[model samples]
Target: MRANRMPPAAMQCRPHTGEALSMAASDARSGRLGFNRLQRRPARDRYDGLARFFHWTFAACIVYASVAGYTLTRLANGPVHHFLSQLNMSIGTVLIVLFPFRAGWKLVRAEPRAMHGVSARQQLLAHGVHGVLYLTMFAVLASGFLMVPNGYTFLGLFEIHTPFQKGPLTDALFAVHRASCALLAGLVVLHVLAVVKHQWIARNDVLRRML
Candidate 1:
C-alpha cells in the first residue's frame, strides 16, 4: 500500500511552526541585548584610595585623642596622667602638622556627588557639618597646643615647643579646647548616626562609597 500523505492544511502549518521558532529566537536575542545595555551602564563613583586612607586615619586619631584627653583631665596628678597627657598632646601635634596636607589634598581632589535621591537640603546640611568639623578640628588642635604652659616631648622622640606661657591666657585656651572637643565629639556622633540611617533605614548604602 502507498504511504498516506498529510493534509494540505497540516502541510501549510509546518511553515508557521518554523516561523514561530524564528520569532522566538529573535525575541531571545533582543532580551540578551537589553541585558548587555544595562551591564554597560556606568558604575557609581567612590572615594579614591588616598581619600579613604585620610578618612580612616582622621577617624582613629580623633577617637584616641578625645578619649585620652578626657581621661587625663579626670585623673589625679600622677605618672599615669602624665603619660596619657603626653601621648594625647603628641597625637594632637601630629594632627596639626598634617592638617595642611590633608586640606590641600581635599582642595585638589574632587568629591563625588551626593547619592541619587538625596535632597538638596540634605546635601547642604552635609556640607555644613563637614566644614564645621574641619574648623572644630583646627580649633581643638590649636587650643590644645597653646594651653600647654611648658614644652612637651613628643613620642619621646623630640621636643615640641608651645608659643604661650603659663598664665590666664592658657586657662582661656584650655576652656576653648574643651568646648571644641565636645563639639567635635557631637559632630562625630551625628556623622556616624547619619551613615547608619542611610545604610540601614533608608537602604541607601552610602557607606559603601567610602569603603
Candidate 2:
C-alpha cells in the first residue's frame, strides 16, 4: 500500500500544472500594474464627506436657477417676474462666490478613480463634458452681470454697481447669456443620462461615489 501511494509532495505539485501557473502569472502581472489594486482599494467606494456635501449643494443651486430662469420667461412684465429674476440672479451670484472655494478643495483633495471596467476613452469624454459645463456656467454668470448695468440689489441688503454702461453691447451680452443657458440645460440632461446608464445598464453604481 505504501509503494502504491503517491508522494505528498507530488500530489501537491500536481494541482499547479502549466495552465494554473500561467493564470497565476497573469494575475501577478495585473496586480503589479495596479489594476487589481485599484478595485480592492477602500477609497474607491465613495468620495470624502466634504466633497459629497459640495456636490449636492451645487446640484441644488443649479436646479433652482434653471427653474427660476424658465419661469421668468413665461411670466409677463410684473412684480412677480421681477422678483423671480432677482432670485435667479442671487442664486447665480452665490454660485460665483462658491465656485472658487469648491474648485480649490478639489485641487487639494484626491478624486475617486473611474469605475474598474470603464474604458479610458469614456473617462476622457466624461472629463471633457465636465470642463464644458464649467465654462458654460462661467459664461452665463459673467454675461448676466454685464446684461444688468444698474447693478444688483441683494434682497435689499446691498447693491453691486454695473461694471459698464448698458447699450448694444449689453443686449449682445444678454443674448450670449440666454444661449449659454440653453446649452447648459442640454449638457445637464446628458450628464443625467450618463449617470442612469452607469447605474442601470452598466450596473456600476457610479453615483454612489458622490453620494
Q: Say which candidate scores most in lDDT.
A: 1
- Cand. 1 Cα-lDDT: 0.89
Sum up the clashes in candidate 2: 0
My TM-score estimates for the predictions, one after another, are 0.77, 0.76
Worst lDDT run of 10 residues, candidate 1, spans 41-50
lDDT of every predicted structure (CA atoms): 0.89, 0.85
Q: What lDDT tens digits, residue by residue, belong to model 1 across residues 113-134? A: 5787789999999989999999
TM-score computed on alpha carbons, candidate 1? 0.77
lDDT per residue as tens, model 2, 1-211: 4578898998888777866999999989978879866766765478889888878888898888888888888999999998888778787788778888777787798778679779999999998998898889788878887898778887667887887787898999999999998998999999999999999999998988887
Error of 1 at 188 (Å): 0.6
Error of 2 at 80 (Å): 0.6
